[model samples]
Target: MTDVAVPPPAPTTQTRARAEVAVAGVRVAPPVRRQAGAGPSDDGHVRLDGRGAALPLDPSSPFEVVDGRLLRDGDDVGLEVEAVDRPRFYDLATADGVPYEQLARLHGTDVLASTVIQTCIRYGEDDRCRFCAIESSLRAGATTRVKTPPQLAEVAEAAVRLDGVRQVVLTTGTTATPDRGARYLARCVAAIRRAVPGLPVQVQCEPPDDLAVLSELSMVGATSIGIHVESLDDEVRRRWMPGKAHVPLDDYWRAWDAAVRTFGRNQVSTYLLVGLGEDPDELVAGASELVARGVYPFVVPFRPLVGTLAADHPAPDPAVLAEVTERVAAVLRAAGMRGADQGAGCAACGACSVLSTAGG
Candidate 1:
């Protein structure tokens, strides 16, 4: 996925105003470094540009960085944004020394990602998820709550040899174990595919009351799986996730029909957030019936992060996130779907949704 040459996209109303100016922000200049947990909320971080777009800004975004590109009050949205650096395996550490940025971080613009169990059995603020900040970066120490699997294959072989990255997302947190943690994410995807050979991972967890733990995470090497039911409106998942709205949406359609028969059709995705009070025509008629059951309703747009419980609340109305991203990008383009045509995580890293540049 790195031969380059991308460009012919923009214009779904300027890609919904560059994805609502990456969740309404553009006053930047410094202190970017952000990306809290369980995914989606760009209060700060992940905005790669170089023609492939990644989106997630607003770390106080006035969108500066002029000469290298992306200005604002001075205009020039002529492309070329910034903000996704900080890798180089975050200055290395592990050998049991920890601190490979607390065991994995780099998401979007090279996707290393990890939360391999940063504590949750629905973490308590009366069963969390009121827009989770997933342990607020493990209570501010920044990270590390349980990594392992050979410290995630020694930080995925030094983040694909010092940040050429590529793929791997992991994601955890509902662990009371019943394979709910998917057998330790199938032993960390068989120790990161025996220490990073083919690379493509994706895990994400939460619908696992067995069903062979989604075929043991596609026989251990993962390739894809999200299962995030951020909102299917059973009263907006019992008023914003009271312990994952007490499970049963027929167990997320029986784990989305055993994860689309074990990660096939559009490789099974799910995460339909958009302003959680729901009813954007019932969230596009429940994301067009989870895209007619092949799933991939990733629709995200409810950012209120800072230690969450809906932070101070407010960030989901860039005109209803461009009318729910043009009605879920026309149900991921009449279900031909395309978050980079998935072979990896988070709708193939369409970095917090513009639905892959609104072409879906």
Candidate 2:
């Protein structure tokens, strides 16, 4: 857990190979050998084949891509681009006219993630999380309004069989219930596990009113759970997630404690996003507290994804991200935790966080 400073260097072949393995993209991690080409532009972006071009490493730039790759000064540097080809399961449909792919989308090589309920109770501008585009994909008709348990089972089975998917992540928009959206997620988990026995699945939702729902999720074969409290600061929570902020921080702590007791240490985690105007020290301190509580803090940079309120907003500087990542990594290492060891959830896959590079 000792902090060790490693000097930053240009991307090496080994580092590139590891990055390709982590991202699981065809352009970046092709099974067959392929040429890696780079072309410089006047604006400092470098074009890579199927993979998107790189951006400057400056943390102040609002421009960023879905892949967690960082860009600095036009040179690719630490960024690695990988193109993920469409999975075969996307072409199939259920008996009831539901497209199988809508049930879940492929993330990397082994992860299947779904927004189980496309509808959100807090979709309004006043209450919605600035970073969320929960219903945008649904409005665009890219996903079904709601995925039936049977429909999810069909797609999960197909994804595991055809695409070699090894884990599943089920997230839902908050609903008006004591259990929040955990009940529906439990049902989905049970159905998917029934269809594909032994497939590790993670369920994510707001902290529910009933802590016992954690046990229900565990009993239903959910290997992990994510109760995302994007920030610990009350003001930051209020500004970024007005609806969720109404639920006190005490509620999150109670839920996280219950989940850890039910799912075991390292099985419970939360998303602590950077770039929400919270002090970097607060993030590190909050993450350290979560570690002490046996909760893995999934530190991800705040990307202003398209279709969200923050779309026009700028992201934190890459240097800031790197700094926060190094600090959180120390905490995670001290707690004997690593994202890959979680078995499921975003932390386990870690494409969204640079902390994984520091061995979080």
Error of 1 at 152 (Å): 2.8
lDDT of 1 by residue, 1-360 (tens): 012222223246566566667676555533335566765564444454543344444556555557667666667766666666667788888765778887777756777888888888887888787888877888887887888899888888888988798888888888887777888888988998998878999888888777877887788879888889888778878888889889988888888878988788778888888877786776777777777778788887887776678777777776676667776776678668877888888788776777766667
* Runs of candidate 1 exceeding 4 Å displacement: 1-15, 20-65, 68-82, 88-105, 108-148, 153-181, 186-203, 209-251, 254-269, 272-283, 287-321, 326-351, 354-360
Clashes of 2: 6
The TM-score values for the models, in the order shown, are 0.33, 0.81
Best by TM-score: 2
* Model 1, residue pairs in steric clash: 26-61, 26-62, 26-63, 27-61, 27-62, 27-63, 28-61, 28-62, 28-63
Candidate 2's TM-score? 0.81
Best by lDDT: 1
Error of model 1, residue 294, in angstroms: 21
Against the true structure, candidate 1 has what lDDT? 0.75
